[model samples]
Target: MTRSPGAGLHLHLDPLGGAAGDMFVAAMLDAFPELEPRVMADVIAILPPEAGQAELSRGQSGGLAVRRFALLPNRRGEEAKPRGHQHEHDHGHGHGHHHHATTYHALRTRIETAPLSQGTAAAAAAILHHIALAEAHVHDMPLDEVHFHELADWDALMDVTAAGSICAALEGATWSLTPLPLGGGLVRTAHGALPVPTPATARILQGYEWHDDGIGGERVTPTGAAILAHVTGGTAGTRRGGRLRAVGMGAGTRDLDDRPNILRVTAFAASSGAGADRIVQLACDLDDMTGEEIAAAADALRAHPGVADLVLVSLLGKKGRPATRMELMVYPAAEAAVAAAIFDLTSSLGLRRTELDRLILPRSATISVEGIRVKRADRPSGATAKAESDDLVHAPTLRARRQLAHRTETG
Candidate 1:
């Protein structure tokens, strides 16, 4: 079914609840059965032969029927080796696995050439590109030289690509999420055993609020964390006013006793009557301009490129000096241009900028004549009218002039 105009989607990342890319995708499939065939095929195609043994199926959790993607160890070939099971090997100064560096350029090309939907493929490539750029910056390597290990694996590729596909499918809608649940503990990887919520995952979760449930396991994967970071723009909070329609639960490979190991995806229809809001506010103080200059500056600012709306307010500053405070509502993208105008036009040494949410309404003009008000929804083309009451009152009438002339002649 097509989503209505004002709809939005809310996704809650339950890290303590086992956050894996496969788990999330399985849950999404269970929630939207129509997408199962496509998503399943895409996911399985990307998995290596050994990893493909794991089966994804529908199941129940917390009385809710959800998709469970269980990772079953392969019994043949290299899979014969214990998969995901910890083994003690004390030959060195600590427990760590050898991490192989996977070139970013190679990964990018592979993702771009993958057989997937256009939107999904693009998103997947974008996420990889972002990761590569970040990694390059951190390691002081060229973007092309940066290498990813676990992040470039088949499972990770599937997860990142699948998440991107899902997001692409839900475009044109706002996505809000709850504070991510980042479970605590050490995680085993090819690079050795690292603390749970790996370094990559931690870096992605920066600037966003997260809570630790002390589960001591690798609940959140780098792929899953990257997906959440890319989708929500790093903002987290509960949303209101949107009608909740469908809820999907994605179950992770491991089961938790304290809570359901699932990610929740809630589809919502935003309130149609709700108005649009602003994203930023730009304000500056100018205590050094004359009245005429201030007026001219206000006009110039209004005409300034990128200034949405300008308002000048008179106020008292320090030492009782009168001043004009200029407030400009600017598009977040245009803050720079508007600020430059303020600096050039007036002697104000500083300007304050803030982000705000404001609502606007539609309006029309009206005019009044002879005590009667007339509403004008639109401007009339080339139409003008003028009225003078005193001139009309003093003018002589034709009938009075004729009577006076006859009376005077007869006398």
Candidate 2:
């Protein structure tokens, strides 16, 4: 059977040693080797012929086989040198640039204008933007003034872009991550010896959960942090339930005696029927607020990134007061934030909260048709498509809007 695009896909990251850009790409490619050629081609297409080359090699970590990705940058007429994950300068600011440094703006422009798929370019640009934000925060400088130091070479670019390509390939996949291991130690950089998880890396992973494992080294590099930040959206948490589909191990440069330096990535598939999951539901009734105030509150709740879905309904309250009852559904991880948002946005003094089991049917992602994005779902009857009503906000007439939606869904 031909699988629909983005159907029932889930990805979980287990950063055993730590995460780096190279390891992220390698692990993803290892799991989906079929994507390797296309990823490499995209990377090469964006980069100049003389810039360098990217390759994947088989290696072993603790006697277990793994795949490693490296960027070999061409130096003059000499053969390209492979800058592996062990090189601190790959993400550190300590090294003096042997070549002209590229600004964050330039890098973003390069990636954005590169000959790559729309999804890959957008993903790669977002990842670079995350890194730029971290760097700007660390240096206390304007984003434009921040020049590429550690990532000046093609090494960081390849790692990040490859990671972006992998993410693009896995679009519609639910991404989750394990708590990262906080390795303790001093790392040498342009600013001299600094604590492990370098300044930029720390900033990039500000909200992420980390636990010290007594393993001392650069666990998560800045590039890795940016990639994770992009994936988790700063809401790093444990994996959800799903059926395992594939697994891949990506090895780093250094192999420790106590543990292997490898990252494990696992892909999962949503089951054939509705999947059972737990979610939090909060409800509140308000009779004292004006319609405008209630509408504003509901809008705020709906706009919150943590909120899954929200509904408002008319109801009769005490004294036969006309009131609006607001109900919000959110995942357990986001319940606290959503609850706080409710209190901040509404005039309600109290809320009714409940943990509910919800069954979700597997659905495909929204795809653009005739420049209109349409969502699709699989049903026993067949497949169905629904055009987003928001896309018709500018329509001249209701009949025209209906006609456009019908064409988008049917075509």
Candidate 3:
């Protein structure tokens, strides 16, 4: 098929009810149905015949049509573990099967050895690694020592693999999600009743925004949290203006009191002018701090994650006072964290925030011409390349620096 205009492209997830591994798979597959056959084939190639068969079926949630994904067990005894829920229950009745507790090493090995495309396997492994890291953090143990009780099950593995494979297939597209819904109340687990957002899920969502829905339940599972962490990197997505290409709705297992438990994935056609995205502009004026303190503050802001750029300008403030004016370009998602960092690192009483639409050209960096790194930006007219100023720091003189930069650019 010709993929109906905008398929397998930039993805923005709306976790209307909540998110899970199956929900992620369903949403992606729903948006791009052309990928179902290959996704399932790849998933089956990795697991044994008796494990289960992957299925993508049409369903409805609160009268809303939706697509659902699940793994059905072939044998009679090994019923498919319920899909789209947290696996925290302790299967102590099995005596030795810690719900098939699989170590981080074992899970990594499985993904590595699976018969999946290189991109798919690597992406899948990275997503799963996010969960492992969360678990390690929550348990206060090293990454190598972390083991999953339910996340290691065949269903979870398949879900992660399916999500990864789909992501790989949708190459070159950026992924983003809305602020995750934070459900209230306690949940039962191996360690007894824990709060709504489990420890692992909480750890995975450290820097991301949260939307409290007041309703109580496990809204974001560890698998879902890991997928979001891998996709957005704890940053908000840019605002892009373009035609909405396609929409797919995936249903969650639970029935919520307020809204239909469905997650929506929307894909957009690539926009023009290289690229256009949104950034938060933060500006503050400080006359009390000395140059050293202002410089320190700028350094801290620059080092913060999601802060794209920072500038410090000497300007005249109120009453002809000489002050340092600080302006920072930060990702919208990281605005809160960056604002907190600014307050902690500077003596500024207040700062100004403005959301700006930024037009940026496609760019990449390459090292060449005496190992000097050059950043090349693609423009409508032509491509332009510039050598990194820091790379020329070792030049003995200004002329030498210019010569090196010219050589790097020309070559």
Q: Against the true structure, whose lDDT is highest?
A: 2
**Candidate 2: which stretches are off by over 4 Å?**
1-4, 73-100, 272-274, 280-354, 360-411
lDDT of 1 by residue, 1-411 (tens): 233221333344443365566766776666666765666565565555665444568786655567765445555554412334331110101122322235777766665666776456655665665566556665687878876755533445666667666655654344545556666656665556666566666666665556677554666666666666665544442343346666778776555667776787776554343335564567767777789988888888776535667888889988999888888887565578678887888888887878888653211111111111111111112112222232234338867544443332221
Candidate 3's C-alpha runs over 4 A off are 1-8, 75-101, 278-280, 290-308, 313-323, 330-345, 349-355, 361-411
TM-score of candidate 1 to 2 decimals: 0.60
lDDT of 2 by residue, 291-377 (tens): 999888888887675676899999899899898999998768778878888888888899999999887655533323233556556
Per-residue CA lDDT of model 3 for 140-173, tens digit only, reads: 9988788775464577778888887876576435
The top-ranked prediction according to TM-score is 3
**C-alpha RMSD values across all candidates:** 21.1, 6.1, 7.7
Give the Å error, residue 13, model 2: 0.3
Q: What's the distance in Å from true for residue 149, model 1? A: 1.8
Checking candidate 2 for backbone clashes, the offending pairs are 94-190
> How do the predictions measure up, each by TM-score?
0.60, 0.71, 0.76
Candidate 3 backbone collisions, by pair: none
Locate the minimum summed-lDDT window of 10 residues in model 2: 81-90
